[model samples]
Target: MKNKLIKMLVGIGLVMGLAACGGGGEDTASGGTDSAHADAEKIYNQKCSSCHGDNLKGGMGPELTAVGANYSQDEIADIIQNGQGAMPAGLISGDDLDKVAEWLATKK
Candidate 1:
């Protein structure tokens, strides 16, 4: 009887752990803004800082400190994917593009 009770508790614990594993990062549902931004900023610094500046202050590229004021997340993603003006297309893509765009969209 004790063994059966332990097994049931272990199963319940496993299910709870799995249930807490997904979503909540993108929209701040988990309140992990710093972690999410750190990840996105890491990607940005790797792929975009050379042109956009370390703090989005602009370098060879225009300042993006307020880019969200002008562009929505989808718009920013389109720009990143398609290229705009002197910016080359596809400098970043896939999940990286989505993350960067989502982070930047909050800059406003």
Candidate 2:
């Protein structure tokens, strides 16, 4: 399985997801100014911009804004963990998945 290949990329055969990731903006949690969302955008710009676009308007990958319509944060997390369409799974799991979902949720 391709997942296996990805898993193999780990150092010393450890099992870890592909990206540095975590849950959504914590500023929303601590009653901050949604700085967490800002962090999410920054993360997206660095990791997802290549395919999804800087503004998330769409490019090689589907447009990220309003992705929550078809998928929830949890679902998106799954895609990040398992791969979909032309995307490779497990590349954006854990924190990174949460970050993307948090940013995408605010695309409205």
Candidate 3:
């Protein structure tokens, strides 16, 4: 009986541990403004910063600091998805594309 009770407690603990491991009411994909921004920043650093510069200033790529002023969100999204000039195509896509575009639009 004691062994059964201990096993039952262990099972309950395991179930609770699994439940706690799962994100609680958090949108793991996009979350909120802060999370989206953090995601965007991470993506940019990984993929774009090499060419666009860490602060979005010009590097091998033209300065993106004023890109928001020059291009609409849709246009920026298109450029990122399709590429232009020396820039290659399909650098980023899906939800990341949208997040990066929206985040970049706020640069200006």
Candidate 4:
């Protein structure tokens, strides 16, 4: 009886371990896309929204709700970095720039 109980406990532990490992950490393993997107949206809201509008539908700047359909990620980054038309340059930079560019690229 003692041996049987021990074996059963071990089996249960093994099963639990396997289940834990199989979880795949989906929230942490999705190539950082989720967090990056959230960050990008936050940044846009804080910095870009004044000109781009709260919804990217254009305020002082042109409409960008579907900018991804018209521009690639690099192109968008370039525009943000260098400024285009009435928009000023360097609103965001470094990793924030990359994250925002990548997130915006998915808008299409």
**All candidates: CA RMSD in angstroms?**
17.9, 7.1, 17.7, 21.1
Question: Sort by TM-score, best first: what order?
Answer: 3, 4, 1, 2
- In model 3, residue pairs whose N, Cα or C atoms come closer than 3 Å (at least 3 residues apart or on different chains), thus clashing, are none
TM-score of each: 0.68, 0.63, 0.71, 0.69
Q: List model 1 lDDT by residue over 1-108, tens digit each.
A: 999677556644543343344223234455476766876787777667766788999866789999999999999999999988766676667766888899999988
Query: What count of clashes does model 4 give?
Result: 0
| Candidate 1 displacement at residue 40 in angstroms | 0.8
Report the alpha-carbon TM-score of model 2 versus the true structure: 0.63
Q: Which residue runs of candidate 2 sit more than 4 Å off their true CA positions?
A: 1-33
Better of 2 and 3 by TM-score: 3
lDDT for each residue of candidate 4 in 31-102, tens digit (9 for 90 to 100): 566776877787776667666678889765678889999999999999988877656676677767777787
Candidate 3 per-residue lDDT, tens place, 27-85, comes to 35658898988888777776677667889996666899978898988999999889887
After best superposition, candidate 4 residue 41: deviation in angstroms?
0.4
Better of 1 and 4 by TM-score: 4
Which has the better lDDT: candidate 2, or candidate 3? 3
TM-score of model 4 vs. true structure:
0.69
Residue 108 C-alpha lDDT in model 4: 77
lDDT of 3 at 70: 87
Per-residue alpha-carbon lDDT of model 2 for 11-87, expressed as tens digits? 21221221344233234455343666677776666566656677778766678877877777777777767877766
Candidate 1 overall lDDT versus native: 0.74
* Model 4 whole-model lDDT (C-alpha atoms): 0.70
